[model samples]
Target: MELSILIVDDDKLLVDKLEETVQWEKIGISMVFTAYNIRQAQKLLEEFPIQFLLCDIDMPQGSGLELLEWIRDNQMEVECVFLSSYANFAYAQKALRLSAREYLLKPISNQDLEAVLSRIIEETREKRERRSAEEQNLGQQRKGKTEFWEDFFRNPSEQERMLAQVLEEGFYQETDVLILEVIKIFADDKDINYKKDLSLFNFVIRNITTEFFENNEQVMEAVAQVSDYEWVLVFRNLGEEERFLEASGDLKKHLNKILPQRSCMYIGETRPLKETAVGWKQIEIMEKKILPGTDGILCERDISEQDQMLSGNAAYRLPPWEIWQKTLHNSEDLDGVCRNICDFLKETFAKGVLTIENLERFLRELEQLVYCYLGEQQMSFSQLFDSREFDRRERDSFHSLDAAVGFVEWIFGTIKGRGNSRRSQEDVVSQVKDYIEGHLNEELSRGILAKMVYLSEDYVSKLFKNTTGMSLPGYIANRRMEKAKDYLEHSSLPVSRIAMEVGYSNFSYFSKTFRDFTGMTPNEYRNHMTKNSSDKK
Candidate 1:
């Protein structure tokens, strides 16, 4: 491939010197573009097929960091290196966050510049080559393997035929021992739309799983997305089971860091090629029995103990919902009532007697009690909680004991808040607004803010909207955009820095939000303010 590079610096002399001194053609750069400022750089970036960017961090109109942030927001894939005279750690940190290739000091020697360019060229080439290889491999081998597994799992009657065909095609051997590993993805965070992004998430997860096991010589791995949030990894040939388990633990940790959702991995026992279907079924059963938030690597033994405890145990019983309901109605001490419920749940969890069945029944009984109480007050559940959020919380409550307790507490607290006077309601809203104002630079979610004021997220959201004439999220976005505009007009901070100041870690998301709010990008907004100021002067 013909490689191209763009040189951006406000210093005309430095730009001229680098362009003249660097042997672009000798170092495999087929084209070189020069720009004096961020605007010029952005125009050239839009117009040309530049593969690499050699930019100065400091510029007059805008910093290179701002330009890179724009490039990222536009989804442009360009390798970048920053050149700065000062060894400022803040600048370096920003550059790193922007995925810059390297940070070099100014007055760079020709030899050093050439070496950096050559290394970048090689790395880019390798990446493209690897991507091409992956595409071809996916087209050829992965399709067949995935199709085979799908047939084997979905059509039990054809499992034998599929296995025979794969064995005949050398995809697997009769002598090989196979192990099935299943990864179940859960949308642990309320903000994640699991169904909407399941395909993309599955693709990324499959790639990560493939790469992690690529170096292992003991097993030949094949990964398939068998369901919306579940992936099945089939490992061929027998190896050290302990080693595989250790690696599975590491893979779980790696995935937890990289993936936005939580995942649980189940490793099935080794089986012959013919019994692969059975092994897959065993893992599926294990998955259904395990709780939602049960993360980490689970093995056959783990599932067996869980099955025994769930089926054989009869000592676990539901919480005393009838008495709790009477207490809630007769007592003015709502906090004490909530405390008692949480305490019971904590004690049950500590005893390890909290089975999923009993926990679910307890939740059902609690909901009934709450509904009956609300009916007595001529109020409905929908009036206090958003139906969708309520359903999500109920599903999440099944994940763990802590989650169940939290749901119970949130429910009772919400009911308590409903009985409060108008003045107290206004006070809660005031507290939430104050919290939002003070923590604009930190992450502010409805759940966090609601917890701070001891109310349900739905109740707080409705109160904020009723009091402020805007939804809670809408208010936060407006405040953030307003702060960003003030900074753009008054300070010389980079757009990325402004984004961080407004509680946005992602420059692209921040820019998109800003544009959505103001109908102009941050740079455009800043330029507009500048033009208006000049006109007034």
Candidate 2:
């Protein structure tokens, strides 16, 4: 692959000299760009696919360390080398922390520069080639295994033939007991389009799983992608179920740390090769019955326990729809009604009778009750609540018991407002703003804010926008940036601390966001502001 490099320095002469003197092409750098400031360097990096960065540690506008921080924050894959006039240990330490390839003092010889550049280029090329080969091998293995399992599952009559094929492949023996595990990945962030990146995530997850089992005593026979977000792993001779469970717990923790998404593992029964299909079918059924929001490792025993609990309470029945409707119609206290609904749902869920089908039926009944109440008040549902909000609530209600209870509370809260005087839009927006200002250090999700005001997230966002002439996220970001600036200008707190004070957990992400907002890194901004303050004084 052809490589490119960018040289950044405040001294234009130094940058020009390097560009003219270095035999970049001989050092595997086919293209070279020179920038005299951090801003210009940032622009060049964004515009060109630069592979290497050689920057001076001290600059007038922004230091090379700050620029490197920005690059790392943006996840740019660039090998960096730092040039410094003074041999400052602190500067070298920070540079190394940011993954700089080398920290060389000023007046370095051309031979040394070429040697460093040549080494970085060779290392980068080898790393890329190794990754490419691994991905290719993983792709081939996945394709073959997926095809085999698809056919094996499809042609039940040819099971004996498939068994023979598996034996020939040495994946399993007739006497070996095999275990099947189904892993499902769930995206916690609503903004992440997981489906669009499932292929890449699948490859990563597969690699992690393979590496995990390689260290264990059990042999992983095969891995197959069963669906868009699901994979099935076949393990042979998985001795001692307790040991397997212990290892699975560790694996789940590792996956949670490394993967960008959450995963749940469902362990199937260990059966002989001839009964592998039956084991897969049983595990699939058990996985479907798992309650929403349930994660981590689940096994057949959990499902079996749930089934027993349900069978033990076979006579349990929910309250009649008429009774619930009557209670809703007569209740003058909205909070009381909400509390009653939540209590009932919680009790039912605890009893193991709140299946997905049961939850759907309950929601349908609640909807009818709501419509009847709205009609009696001479108000339409859409007039009282946005249709989009209602749809979102309904869709989210199926995800978890907490979501279902929240939906119910929102529904009743809206109904109560129809009978009473409603708060003005300005008042609601002001209330939300005050809360946000007071809680800048805490998580401020739309859902949490919506719950605080008994409004839907969509409704709250629209209301905030209508009142402030800015989107909800835009307002939050502005407030955060303003606060961050105040801290940087007046206080001596570290940038990472300021980031936490403004509700950001990841320091790198905070740096990126701050740069995008202010056009300078935190340190640069602090320096510039301090200099201006000194001049004014």
Candidate 3:
């Protein structure tokens, strides 16, 4: 494929020499375009579909830095290589800031120039393939129903224009864009892991894109990134200001669900995208004040509201543990202790940005304490609930706490109830043991015992194991083997019928367990018992 090169320099003689002597055609460069200043370069950028831009930093009209700034502002896809004569570190540093691909000092060597050209040639080949795929995406974009994000990355300029056009096609022809930034704050000690950060970026992006796609098919196009350990979700909105606010609130809820365990998200409010320069100006200011700045999606309103609430004061509150520990003594009131502990937890959740996991730890520890208290006094939460005999009106209050505290509290409470239930829970176990011994020929699962005792299969299984050191099946097998031996010694029952009399429908499983428990199988033991009985007779 033929390569195109654009050289921006005011040195007529040097340009002539480089143009004539170099085998540009041999290296695959076919057409070359020249621009003397930043103005001419801007015109060339708009008009010609040039591949490589080799520009001198010090130009007569305007420097290459100004041209680079323009490219960044317009979101243009271009790789720049800087050229300058004077040995200035500051200029090179500024060039690096602009993301210049390479820096070369001007008294240019043909060999170094050739090397740069070769590198550009290789890069352009890849760019050509990317450009081809981008064109295909552009074709898809014209269909109006394709995924906006896929096309958005390929042609950002076209996407911004299309979003504007679609909004015009819709209710409002004139609209302002709001750029909201979401920052996530992490634990201070550890540096952010990149892979995890990227995963978070993808997760939040999926949420934002899905939410927008669900609500507004036209105006709410968005993009997300993980930059400097912060997850940034940028949205393009052209709807009512109130609608955007509502969307921001919904997005925050969405963020909560994705990383409920560890991250706290702070969202900034939507600002005018038209004023992108000003919006960018606010980015540093916003970053300075944002909480949970590392992983959250925060709008401008989030930061401003927090600022107003704190009123420029650094908000530092005591940890829940320290607060609970202070002015503490051995208190016998279980209800008072539980309330104090729960209040401490609630305060931590509100003020300290506790993750869902840490909140769960607090609940678990609290429940463990409750269980220890109950066990010492021989009582249960269920008994307390049942004794209250809460009317239908008061029952709703339980549901409210159940919902607010979430499934963790319910589980912890249930575990505590199970621990209390065990002391008086063996009546059913005794009955079950009697029934199993009486009916050895019948199938004896935890389910059957549960039915007999009026309990769940799971509860009965746990209860049986907790009450008896041996498992139900193991105890039943041992009992059946003992009965079979008695029948063999005293009665003239056939070995098969004796096996049937014992709990062996298959007899093989029974024999295996019997042999495993004792030294012999059921048949072998029965034969020995019969021989001994015959000898005694």
Summed backbone clashes in each candidate are 0, 0, 25
Candidate numbers sorted by TM-score from highest down? 1, 2, 3
Model 3 scores worst on lDDT over the 10 consecutive residues at 389-398
Give the poorly placed runs of model 1, Cα more than 4 Å off: 1-139, 168-170, 188-196, 215-220, 292-296, 305-316, 326-359, 369-386, 399-537
lDDT of 2 at 155: 69
* Cα error of candidate 2 at position 81, Å: 36
lDDT of 2 by residue, 308-349 (tens): 332434334565667666766686556776687788888887
Candidate 3 accuracy as TM-score:
0.32
TM-score of each: 0.55, 0.49, 0.32
- Clashing residue pairs in candidate 1 are none
How big is the positional error of residue 281 in model 3, measured in Å on the Cα after superposition?
A: 14
Query: Which has the higher TM-score value, candidate number 2 or candidate number 3?
Result: 2
- In model 3, which runs have C-alpha deviations exceeding 4 angstroms? 1-178, 181-208, 211-214, 217-220, 223-232, 237-239, 248-266, 271-300, 303-336, 343-412, 419-537
lDDT at 89 for candidate 2? Answer: 93
Better of 1 and 2 by TM-score: 1
Tell me model 2's lDDT, rounded to 2 decimals: 0.79
> Between which residue pairs do clashes occur in model 2?
none
Worst 10-residue lDDT window for candidate 2 reads 308-317
Q: Which residue ranges in model 2 land beyond 4 Å of their true spot?
A: 1-147, 150-161, 168-171, 187-192, 195-204, 214-216, 250-263, 289-298, 301-316, 320-353, 366-422, 429-454, 461-537
